[model samples]
Target: MNVKNVYIAYTNCITPLGFDVDSNVQAIANGVSGIRLQENSTLMTAPFYAGVIDSDKLNTAFAALSDAKATRLEKMMVLALDPIIKKSGVELNAKTALILSTTKGNITVLNENAVPVPDAYLHQLAQNIVDFFGFTTQPIVVSNACVSGIMAVSVAKRLVQAGLYDNVFVISGDEVSEFVLSGFNSFQAMSDVPCKPYSANRKGVTLGEAAAAALVTINNSEAKAKIAGDGSINDANHISGPSRTGEGLVRSIESAFNEAGVTAQNIDYISAHGTATPFNDEMEAVAFNRLGLNEVPVNSLKGYYGHTLGASGLLETVIGLESMARNKVFASMGYDEPGVSQPINVLAANLDTPVNCFLKTASGFGGCNTAVVFQKVNNGR
Candidate 1:
């Protein structure tokens, strides 16, 4: 049996910075950040910085898709995915699959008297989107902490490679709700200012909201990037904190590199999961250094998008694909100086260099880490 090659055919994103992939890339290129000081007392007692989508703008865009009522997160997800599904022109049939990745799906509904609503359930949230699109197959949900997005991509690759489906649509999203804000505030992890990844003065994470979509298929024609290899590992070091030695991350990257049949030198860039949290940035540095990737040009998009929870991994991966297409590496926003103990070449400015292959890594709560390697198809349209 021959293993099929997985390709990312189409991608889109909905965030405060922009509604589509090109707009988001242009915003990053211009050094524009969506993270801002939010002063909504309903979400928090004091003002906090976050990357929040404009409800009015989102509603206006969603209105064109459907007039039926939907949650903020569902709307964003649909908006991000609608174009991909339309552009792919793939028929919704048994051969097609839908996978939704989110850390908090309609979780805001629980804030209403602390009672769980039907939409609050992850499956129900997926079902709503499935029904909207009239998907014939049952929807698959991926909700594994912050790594959910990239993990969903990894899952899609495996499914297509297994011949279970010709194509899989992966959508990931999370919102900045009172619950999310309070949860991070309780951990004392909410940064007052925009989060700075791998910065000496970095404080903590600034919560954000976003939705991203990608079409994973065996088709290489007009492919954006090829999913070469993937690996996921859990260190079980802590329920909330990552391993001090970056054990899980190191293993995950190594597994991905092994599967891709490539070494650190082959990787042109790295889109790191720089949450801007002290421990996470330090842990990633340790992991990259352990794998001899100390000199790889690495950057985190968290500074521009803040920490978009479940959407971060996929959102960043979409940006990485654009970087490869353009042969440019976007700077790691908010990085002033190296704060981590190990030596890693964190991109300080936009670099115009060849980016044929890149690595995407994400670490979430419960010590889970995922790494995926993607390469540009030489003949891609």
Candidate 2:
């Protein structure tokens, strides 16, 4: 079998912060956060903080696309993918695949008055988007808890390597619905303010919603970031929490390192999955310490976008790629003092240091952990 190099060719983002990557990155560069205090009696009896997109703004963006008929979630997904597909100028043929990543696909339909076809089925969500864009191949939906985003990318790379497709477009999204809000609230995991990841006074998580898309292709010449390696492992530690000792995360990172022929020393930075939860942050710290990556500068995008569920992994990866292109390391927002017991270099301020290679990681419910290695394309190292 012939192995092909996978490269992220184009990217797009639609989040509470902004509708496109440039706007969102600028917001981060200026220390702006999308998270805000929200009041929805149906979702929660009391006020809660969350990163939620404005309904009017979403409608405007979707209206601009002449797709006003799509549901809010579907609009976000299509709005995310349309730009990348246009930018890539890649035709949707039999060899080109479309992948949708989300934990909840139109789950809001359950609480809304609109009755959708094949209602609430994730497959229908993917089909709706692909059907709009005229993809010849069957739509693929990935919904593995919060790992859905990066997992979709990993799956796309593997499929491309196996000659199932020459190009794959992965779009991941999840809306901040009443169901999700109540679910997190039930866990006592909803923070009252913008999350402070890896901070001494950190609280719990602030949920967010977003849709992001990237084109992964075998053509490395026009690549933004090269997908060097990727891996996933499950410890079955708990249903909603990660391993206390970071066993699964460590193994996942090691697997990617082995496949990419890189080491802890080779990594320039870590795009950590710091959810701002006490146990989650500590577990990530332990993992980095055990892997000899204690000093690697790391930041969690959650401080800006909050925990965006399945969209987070892909959203952060897209921003990480932008960081490499610009040579600017955005600060881990809301981080002041180290709270985790282990020694981990959590970024407190933005660094202008040049980055060549970085690791993106995500640990989700059901003890699923995934890590992927990416290197800057055409960097003059």
lDDT of 2 by residue, 1-381 (tens): 556778887999999889999999999999999998988887678898999999999998889887446888898998999988988889899889999999988887877555653759999888889888999999999889988899899899888878889999999999888898889888998777799999988888999999999999988766888888999999668988889999889999999899888999989999999999999999999999999999999999999999999999999999999888888888999898989998898888889978889999999999999999998888342
Note the residue pairs that clash in candidate 1. none
Off by over 4 Å in 2: 113-117, 379-381
Residue 354 Cα positional deviation in candidate 1, in Å, after optimal superposition: 0.7
- Report RMSD for candidate 1: 1.0
Q: List clashing residue pairs in candidate 2.
A: none
Best by TM-score: 1
**Which segments of model 1 are wrong by more than 4 Å?**
none
Candidate 1 accuracy as TM-score: 0.98
- lDDT per residue for candidate 1 within 175-194, as digits (tens), equals 99999888998999977779
Worst 10 residues of 1 by lDDT: 110-119
In candidate 2 the C-alpha lDDT for residue 156 amounts to 91
> RMSD in angstroms, candidate 2?
1.6
Error of 1 at 81 (Å): 0.6
